[model samples]
Target: MNAPRSLDARLTEQRNPRTARIDQLATLEIVDLINAEDRMVAAAVGEERQQIARAIDIVVECLRAGGRLFYVGAGTSGRLGVLDASEMPPTYRTDPALVQGIIAGGLDALVRAQEGAEDHAGDGAAAMDEKNVDARDFVLGIAASGTTPYVHGALQRARERGARTGFLLCSWPSEALMKTHDVVIAPLVGPEVITGSTRMKAGTATKIVLNTISTAAMVKLGKVYGNLMVDLQVTCQKLQDRGERILMATVGVSREEAQRLLDESGGHVKTAIVMASRSLDAQEARQRLDAAGGSVTELVGTLPVA
Candidate 1:
């Protein structure tokens, strides 16, 4: 029988020379060492800006075509994927089905470690079937080591269904992986401070990458106006406050008038902005937004001076 390949060659599995004596260091020294290592993560992600940007463009295209985006992974990668997917609705008022996260071991694995679940390539393929993935969808596989069987399997199945595939890994990807995915975002964050514990730097890098992809995609979809979350769903007091404030700032309305507009638009910031700026009723504002593809600025043409 052939011996298993050693993970020692992987950047994420290698030990850091700078922290070789970490065990013997004082508390302050240990903190400083970790901080220094953490500082390198941003630069590593920066090096992959082109790939990340390409991933965003792919996501935007897929979504605009009425398809969805999926993030597939296991363990910490899975958790991060779920976290990013679940935030889309409240943050940008996106439909729940538009962005999804598929983790190995199912929802039960989310709270517990399902280390063995990631080994079954067939189960990953099954998941693609469950989602009814098609040509319009985009699937992104997240694996810190760039060797998760489940992620690769799902990506393979997604490709078979004619969907665009993407890969996000912390370690350097092999030629096969790069060739397989439509876009490859490999942020080489090096080894974790606690050796193979990738929930640290690798986790942070994944969060940043997902944030950029989702936020940029939403912006392209007209979920944002300028720098504000104009499509936010005012489901609670904080968001209600935010919605009114967004109206107050953008359409040059007073706080009370902003609240009235928010009420008029049923808590939709973008619609409220359109109604206030264009001097239209809720239905008229909605029609204008629909005509302009949901862009408040596009429909209103210009913001009223404050």
Candidate 2:
């Protein structure tokens, strides 16, 4: 016979004393109570700054080595992971294969909740196998409650396949969990306003953490120059307009000249900047950028402060 799982030990599963009387409060009071609880979330995330920075370094290392990054989770965690991965291509001009998200119930679960999908550990391991995760790759598992069998299973297999792994949870992390992976990010956001409703505070913390990791990695990889996304490629009207504006501001060109440069550079913002700043043609600008390792700063100095 097996012992029963103790849900009480999980910080995310515990009832909050602060919101104990939330049900009896008026609508405005209820809103205030929830707001108060939400305020603590940022501080909790801040407490894990060092751990988050470490995770970013690992991700940068993996990407620089031509390895991919995978975010594995289930439920809200899975959805958040997928959301972060999907934004990389358009935001950073990265290949979609560079960052991936694996949910226990797969893509279908992304639109609709799939009950019991997180219970099967074997499925998680299979997902890692299907992705062909290797030593050069980095896999980060997200589980708010810190006990999701599926996430653990996937990370375990990822490690077995020689991939570096990390874990992100909203509750308190055990010592074993800290030592098991290269990094463990646990933002103790306390219990939710509705008691065990981790989708509130925990979800917010997870989103913030993912944003920091991916954005920092992109900036380090020269996808961003100063505060501008230099790697941007004009894919839509909005992006085309934005790219032209970027060139106008950075290269000291008029709108017409910016548009011409953009067209000449095939709508590549960084290449256009290189062409305009270095007084080079498109081909020469591309060669210079390639030689400088795609760093606009390496070709042209840093953007002047406004």
Candidate 3:
């Protein structure tokens, strides 16, 4: 089978007429060329906003039904997945298992090059099965080239077992690979800053795309409120302070009053908002939040404007 033309790879090719002086160009000229291509990364992602929004909605649905989100990739893509997953626990106070990342060379792949590990497509399939992926789950295989055997094999197995399978590739749509996946998201951010080093521009594009998908989906899942990460953990005093401030500003209560509600709600921003605005106590606040499906917007949405 003919390989798919790398849509990004084609676009990012240095277009200026090659000259004998090309080898003698100054470092700044090379930097300028790279900057030009890097500037297009955001535009590529922006063009796919609607598709990204759809992916977010689907991810939220999976999590709502007690499912997990898994990211499988090799090399830079794998490392990026690991980095994003690692941040979730601290940033959003979510369970570590809720969003997991599997790199080609296991945890070691995050740092050093895992040569040949990506070629083991069977390893990718094994990882998915080990995770016990279910229909309620979403698995996204990210590969800048769009033809990573490791990711393709995982997508194939993920589909066969009934999990919603998605692919994030930088290549033009290749039917051979696309047919194996359910959702195909190709944000063709053309090429790398350094020839084949996808870690540069391609990786940046993938990271931005992943961040958007997960964050937007979280918002849909009621994890965010008025641009605030309401689900942020109050385990730290700083977060607890932030929770108090959010409650006071959102509920229009005094600083002291918001702190009181925060203490009553055990530092829960959602509960504190409900308790302060609705004049309900802790238990009632929880009941109200639960009824609102954990959304502060919905609960306060019904109250008269202060």
Candidate 4:
């Protein structure tokens, strides 16, 4: 007879020996224990740095080719994916369609727990088709457990549609999984403090990894100049203030000049910087930015080191 499979085979589901007595401890002790476990999350993510970098390269390539990026998952994983995607537009001024998030139970699943929705593999496959995934697109599935049926199904269909697919998990990936995806980022963050409560360390690791990938990709695409988010669109009072400050700092202009440039450039920080640095009108600065592939550094040279 074949040996029985262990129910606790997944690292995310296994008990953390260090945190076994957490429930019996005082509130402060519990907090300290959780914090101790959290410390391991960053190192775990660092261990997958190469895989993460590879994923970023794929995302940048697909995006540059006029394709979109999709993140698919369920539950906490899905919510995190959506959160990351939603920030791209305002942060980098990307189109809403450039990056998307597909949760197994859809938007309704975001706020409430749709635990049963993750079991339907068909729903996952259908989502890929609905998105019209293509060869130029990149799809990344996030599932800390490494065995979410919904995530697997979506990735399988995404691959079938000729899209480049990648997987991010908090557990060890099987050989088959390693061979199947274009890149597999497994940040083994160990068991959660409360057994399988992955929202703790695993979630932290996932957020960090996503942040690194998206931030690096944006930086490479020239959405940043000297570590500043120069590609920002001034949409609010806070952003307006930030845009003016960026202009003042990068273009060596006074507050009045910065405000004038900002208004002239229509609240675009990069355009304002280009207009001030190159001594060009808004129209001319826009033309130069377009010619330089939207790269501020290409037209104005690198920002001086502070």
Candidate 5:
């Protein structure tokens, strides 16, 4: 039987016959070679920083305006999307539903391999419908070869319905599949040291891209304060301690006074800063942050550093 026409079936332009013999090397040498190649991934990503920043700006705007962010993929690519979506709530206090992931085989794929799942295009469409996805959000698809059925299906459908689309895959310019999205970030990391096991190089690239997408988007949404996780969860005592310190340092209040204002603001870090720095009450602090669009820095960057 002829193989399916896929981005995978497509040939890579880099012709390095030496890499095919990578396994014949001593184990240590092979590991060293792989590690050496891995270093190039960051440089590739660095070159795409502007593209990454643009995606972040668009996604963050949707999020703050009450829109959702969706990730779609298959296999290792799918798992990476799930991992990023799962982390946002705990790390940045986002509503879990607002940031979501849809893998080809559903949640079971995260634990065990679901090889057949990748072939089903209907699964991709069904998953998006199940989530009520629409023009109000953004969809970022992941397909290392830039041609996973599930990823392409999602992006195509997203565009059909007026939802903006973006892609994080391993490809280059002039690939027309690249043109379907508002932004295309194909961090061309070439091939895997182990060949066909995209779970290696391709997976690493996917994770790095997802990390950049979510973290930078959150930062643009005012979820960060001068590199500190200003929007970090206050569900634990450690977070409570950190929040109090942020209050003290940003407001220039004595430690004792900072704690007092933190208590007064009900342990909300941004509000506490407003009270300590601006002498505003909890209600007033809330208003100030709202007025500043949730950016503590914008709300108080003019204040003397603590």
Candidate 6:
């Protein structure tokens, strides 16, 4: 009889028949083959659209309740989580603590490979404790194989602490895993081009999912106005220019006037629009924005032509 198959024998770890002889392929052929494999990632993620949307709602709920969203993972999974978390503060002007990433090996692991760090379940639990995860917080564990001890331990401890937990896996997880997480996002990107190398397709899928979740949550929080990132912090020249452009396009103002409005609103595009539309001073515009939940459209009711 064949021996029992371990978790590594799962689909994500299995070989892809399409790229079986990739080593023998020409340079151009290899690129074409890799691109073909990448084409499937989006559709796989699309299949989990409902679950991804639900995850976003859970995150939004946690943030609205003054709680935070945490992403726990190891290796490539961990890196992607950190990348997404780090970008949110700059992109949306949200507090860094609002969205956090906890890799198994900590900051040092970010640069070098620390594969051994993922073995300690106790350490994973300790990280959750340090973060003070509670009922209001939501923690999402990213594990390509759905079997990372570090991720599993973190989610388990997070649940024990009354935190909402979710799991993002590249494989079809067992029934126990499905039951454990409040949300399970399985993109099922299938096997990698280079067998067992999850950093390829799995990494791309994780990036896409993280992007969608954070972007949607920010939108729901009114960090965006239509398709524009209105809550962006003007800490640099590029952002200042973008902010001015947003004001000019939204309110039909000249570049100079947009800069003036931005100055009045302390470089906040949303507040600048409110100030311009309602003929209010910076303080009154901020008050109206706060009252209207920082929604430019709601605060102004209707736009006024230049």
Predicted model with the maximum lDDT: 2
* Model 4 spans > 4 angstroms off: 1-6
Better of 4 and 5 by TM-score: 4
Candidate 5 segments whose C-alpha is farther than 4 A from its true place? 1-18, 172-174, 253-263, 302-306
**The candidate that achieves the highest TM-score relative to the unseen native structure:** 4
- Score residue 228 of candidate 6 by CA lDDT: 83
lDDT of 1 by residue, 5-51 (tens): 33688888887777778999999999999999999889989999999
Question: Which ranges of candidate 2 are over 4 A from the true structure?
Answer: 1-7
TM agreement with the true structure for every prediction: 0.95, 0.96, 0.87, 0.97, 0.87, 0.95
Residue 214 CA displacement from its true place in model 6, Å: 0.4
Off by over 4 Å in 1: 1-7, 302-306
Higher-ranked by TM-score: 3 or 6: 6
Task: Give the clash count for model 3.
Answer: 1
Write the residue-wise lDDT of candidate 3 on 1-306 in tens digits: 543444444433422232223457798987776677788889988887877777787888899999999999999999888888887876666799999988988998887899689998898898888888878899999988776889878877887778998888776867766676667778777645545667877788899999998888777777777787777767887887788777766877888887777778887777777777788899998898878888887877743444
Candidate 5's residue-wise lDDT over 1-306, tens digit each? 542333444323333344666858999988888888788788878788888988888898788778899999999988999999999987887889988988998899999999888887767777777777778889998877776787777777777777888988776545586566788887877766755677776688788988988998888888788877767657788887787777666666777886787678776676777666676899998898888888887877743533
TM-score of 1: 0.95
lDDT per residue (tens digit) for residues 157-188 in model 2: 99999999999999889999988999999999
List pairs with backbone clashes in candidate 1. Answer: none
Worst lDDT run of 10 residues, candidate 5, spans: 3-12
Model 6, range 144-232, lDDT digits (tens) per residue? 99988999999999999999999999998899998888999999998999888999999999999999999999999888887888888
Q: Better model by lDDT, 1 or 3?
A: 1
For all candidates in order, the CA lDDT equals 0.91, 0.92, 0.79, 0.92, 0.78, 0.91
lDDT (10s digit) by residue, model 4, range 1-306: 543333888999888778766778999999888889999999999999999999999999999998999999999999999999999999999999999999989999999999999999889999999999999999999999989999999999999999999999999999999999999999999989988899999999999999998899899888999999999999999999999889888988998888899888998999998888888999999999888888999999988888
Worst 10 residues of 4 by lDDT: 1-10
Model 3 has an lDDT value of: 0.79
